[model samples]
Target: MTVARKRAILTADSVPMLPAHVRLIFNEKRDSWVVLAPEKILWPDDISVLILQNCDGARSIGEIARALSKEFSAPFSEILGDILEFLQDWSDRLLIRLAEQSGGKP
Candidate 1:
């Protein structure tokens, strides 16, 4: 018998981090940042790089969105929506994981 693990859902309260098997590195040869995971390599755009860099397992989704919103002077709701979608896509690929939440409300 085989068991499958359930996928985690991303919420405003969820903290995101790169999984142990995954890494984000600057590829000197390519002159850009790349996400290295096993045999997979992904070249994310500049904006995506900013978002991924903030996935330090410390900030919740909401916090990240707020920071980016302030930095870019964009609306919070818009930034939040973009972040949620971006993180969800990466999470589904097993590149990102939700860290254990510290005591706090979303």
Candidate 2:
């Protein structure tokens, strides 16, 4: 993570959501959902699509990662860092936001 990214305040309770200009849409042609923004479209792979879907303003990063791990039969630690890095990258691009909340650290 960059210095600026490290400066971001992310925690277990911080809810993440698509930006106002970004929307999640199903692409029937591709049989997947995509992140649609004003100037760009993100076609994430199967796992990534699920990750993005879980970014709704309800589940925390920690909660999402935990649930995804069990659902996918993967280890929590294996996906935790990647999930955080993915969210932080989108947050940096203004495509997503980690809403402020007080709780456990991710």
Best by TM-score: 1
lDDT of 1 by residue, 1-106 (tens): 9999787789988899888798999999989999999999999999999999999988999999999999999999999999999999999888888887323221
Q: Which residue pairs clash in candidate 1?
A: none
lDDT of candidate 1 vs native? 0.89
Task: TM-score for candidate 1, please give it.
Answer: 0.91
Best by lDDT: 1
TM-score each candidate. 0.91, 0.79
* Residue 31 of model 1, lDDT score: 97
What lDDT does each candidate get? 0.89, 0.76
Model 1 residue 73 lDDT?
Answer: 100
Where in model 2 is the C-alpha error above 4 Å? 1-9, 101-106
Model 1, position 6, has a per-residue lDDT of 80
In model 2, the Cα lDDT at residue 96 comes to 71
